[model samples]
Target: MIKCCNYDRKYPMAWDREDFSRAYRRLAPVYDHGLLLYELVGMRLRRYRREAVAGLHLQPGDTVVDLGCGTGVNLPLLLGAVGPTGRIIGVDLSPEMLEQAQRKIDAEDWCNVELVASDMVDYVFPPHVDAVLATLALATIPDYDSVIRTIASALPPGGRLANFEMTWPEAWPDWLVKLGAKLQQPFGVTTDLKDRKPARSIQRHFARCDSSERYFGAISFCIAIRQAGTGVNV
Candidate 1:
């Protein structure tokens, strides 16, 4: 029998790091299949991933970091943009998720991609990354603000950051929003939808921020550019 992870009990306002890691461990094996509805039911989350990566405007031989990169869904896109000469550092908390990502790298014979199993909050940022991309993963991070600040500090001037994650829509009725949050609960999303606002946090760290909302405003894709002389010098 397949074991299911339970997260129904009360968690902190933000997810505990260990708790989040355990949750993704149980979900990793079937995680990609679980997202089929979003891909096939007109939601097309992959489109947002593509758009976000495109905003990076990467060149051959550039290095990029894929923060919270689950199952390497964003790898193919990143690989296409950076080419063989570039490097991709895919980071996640779950070893299981990173295992799945490793399989993809092996299958594609991609020598440039590296998988790092580490929490986003504590993971060391490599110097001079051309871009950082995270999709559908930021909302699950408990200390997302601090992570953004760290990214801002590590990136070179003019490095790009792109994030895509769930959002609570203002126009949606409270009942509908509640229902949506409930639907997403099993996937380890915070019960309170408002905590998923990465765009607002991104704006604070980045000088040029561009955002696009989709999926009835329940999803947001943001691309922000780190301006010269912004944040602490790393």
Candidate 2:
């Protein structure tokens, strides 16, 4: 059965972390199944994940953080990239989501995976993290610019950040973009979809930023590397 929590408020103009936590608390169990349907329907969202992660170009023994790592779907790829000696810290706002992710770690006997339950804004990132990744998660963060700034500060110079998020292409009709936003509302996506360009925000903090759009311009992926001598004031 598909279970979901109550969200009586109107769709938010930006990320309401509390509401998203509540919604995902119930949605966690069936989240993977829902993604399967999304993929079958031609979204092929997992491809975006794979592409973004590959861009990180991770090495064995490196430590990586999977920001907003819902249900640990990227753990396998991360573990593969980093090898058994590497570590992965998966952070999410929902405890239920982390619970599911923990199960995946246990099932795979991955001794290096760590799951933390906290909002991205307040979470304490560890030092020496080689890369950070967020897939289909940044758009849900109301203060994504702040979050990007935090990530930039936490990483060492040349550290990588990869993100895959929703986007509305200029070529797409107004009606289609509206329809896309409407379809995403049930999943706690921000109502202001047109204004959430995560790639641009990421570029402000990084020296090198590479971005691409996929799924007919409905999705955008960005990989940025922190530059030397830049520090976040916050």
Top-lDDT candidate index: 2
> Against the true structure, candidate 2 has what lDDT?
0.82
Q: What is the C-alpha lDDT of each candidate?
A: 0.81, 0.82
List runs of model 2 lying over 4 Å from the truth: 1-12, 228-234
Cα lDDT tens digits, model 1, 126-183, are 7778899988887777678888878877788888999888877777665665566567
RMSD of 2: 3.4
Ten contiguous residues minimizing lDDT sum, candidate 1: 2-11
- TM-score between candidate 1 and the true structure: 0.90
Q: How many backbone clashes does candidate 1 have?
A: 0
RMSD each, Å: 3.2, 3.4
Candidate 2: TM-score?
0.90
Model 1: residues >4 Å from true position, as ranges?
A: 1-12, 229-234
Supply the global lDDT for candidate 1: 0.81
Error of 1 at 207 (Å): 1.3
> What is candidate 2's lDDT per residue for 1-234, written digit by digit as tens?
322222333333564776787788778999999788778869988888888889999999999999999899999999989999999999999999899999998887999999988889898888799999999888777688989888988899888999988777768765665566666655765446566788888888777889888888888889998867665333
Scored against the true structure, residue 166 in model 1 reaches a CA lDDT of 83
